[model samples]
Target: MTSRSSWNTRNSDVAWAKFDPIAYVDHNYRCIQEDDAEILRIVRDHFADHFRTTDTTGPVSGIDVGSGPNLYPALAMLPWCEEITLLEYSPANVRYLEGQVMSYDANWDQFWDVLREHEAYRSLGMGPRDRFCRAVEVKEGDLFDLARHEGR
Candidate 1:
């Protein structure tokens, strides 16, 4: 089993320690530009209810467990949750996610466009990338250490 501190140290043994953020985006996120209609449909269906109401009863907070350098999955949760806690095991990935939030990257445009293509999201007429950066909060934590990460 992976120890709690194993990823904390970012040991070379950890496969994710060598993760490449730009390459990851190029490989995964750019697919949205290719064809995101189906993706938008699925995610929109999952999160459509969250946008129907403007009250506090809706999902107020959500967590991205083991979030790597990927941002699309978090984008999928954007409409449903007000605050998204990005829990990452690798320090490298944590820093990467934090950097993206601190400064929105232009490369993510395709991903945002894909999300915005949905009628529900398109109606917002707002910048999805900017909104995503604002809503996300990065936290470094262990995925296996149930005691510490359970209620976070």
Candidate 2:
């Protein structure tokens, strides 16, 4: 029988890890869903509006904590960031993200389709693999273990 952590998972992140990153990515992201497309648009638009007037004299760093097998979040920050971090807890997920970042899976192209609809995203004017591989960094880490950062 498979064991599960019994600790109160409601208010905390304490738990045992279990998931198949390959299966998860294939099932959820391999085929672009309506929900995922909507989310990509929402994130893209939100970021577009948020940074519209801000004077970002330099490229900023971005991080997605407990990012799992998802790459859309990191994609949303692609234009504005010089470097991005995908911090995941699962070992399998870390490996998956590493490969995906280095040699970005083609499945994510649909997600980029939505992102490119935005002015900032399209303004990038470069291929996704070149831009993404240049900017993304994958690290194995849990959410609760993070140290305080200056940003919100």
Candidate 3:
């Protein structure tokens, strides 16, 4: 099988940076709500049943491979995860995500209110999502670097 690194290197500059979360939510609201909710529920339940109980550690570490502009997986895993590393090869997307995080203002209740309408906020607890946003560490590299660092 070809390694993830090989794929990442080949498509490092793929233009996933153009994705807009708000536009995506507006276009595919129902599917995003339903599919994402189901997937997140399954993941949460699985982790809660297997890893959470099995591991003595309070929180588990996870990685979001090929994390794009949408950080859904990292947000979903926040309830049970301690740290989440978002690996993205595109410098543009990395900068965009960083900008979103940095520009988020607690005083802008209207923006938040509009965002809360999306089921993503409800299914994944708002607090947990915020925690995940803070916990997420965006790294510029391929999967091979991650494997090497983790000693996988």
Candidate number with greatest TM-score: 2
lDDT: which candidate is best?
Answer: 2
lDDT, candidate 3, equals 0.58
lDDT of 1: 0.72
Pairs that clash in candidate 2: none
lDDT at 23, model 3: 58
Deviating ranges (above 4 Å) for candidate 3 = 1-33, 102-126, 150-152
* Residue 151 in candidate 3, Cα distance off native in Å: 2.2
Cα lDDT listed for each candidate: 0.72, 0.83, 0.58
Worst 10 residues of 3 by lDDT: 104-113
Q: Count backbone overlaps in model 2.
A: 0
Q: Write the per-residue lDDT of candidate 3 for residues 60-137, one digit (tens) a residue.
A: 677888775655666555555667887876676566456555333332333233334545444554564367566778
Q: CA lDDT of 70 in candidate 2?
A: 89
- Could you tell me which residue pairs clash in candidate 1? none
- Model 1 stretches with alpha carbons more than 4 Å out: 1-14, 31-37, 49-59, 123-126, 146-152
Q: At residue 61, give the lDDT of candidate 3.
A: 75
Residue by residue across 131-152, what tens digits does model 2's lDDT show?
Answer: 8899999988767667564344
Candidate 1, residues 2-119, lDDT tens digits: the string is: 8888768744456766677667767776555444557656777767765565456645787888888877767777766668988887788888898889666776666666777666
1 or 3, greater by lDDT: 1
- Among residues 3 or more apart in sequence or in different chains, the pairs in candidate 3 whose N, CA or C atoms overlap within 3 Å are none
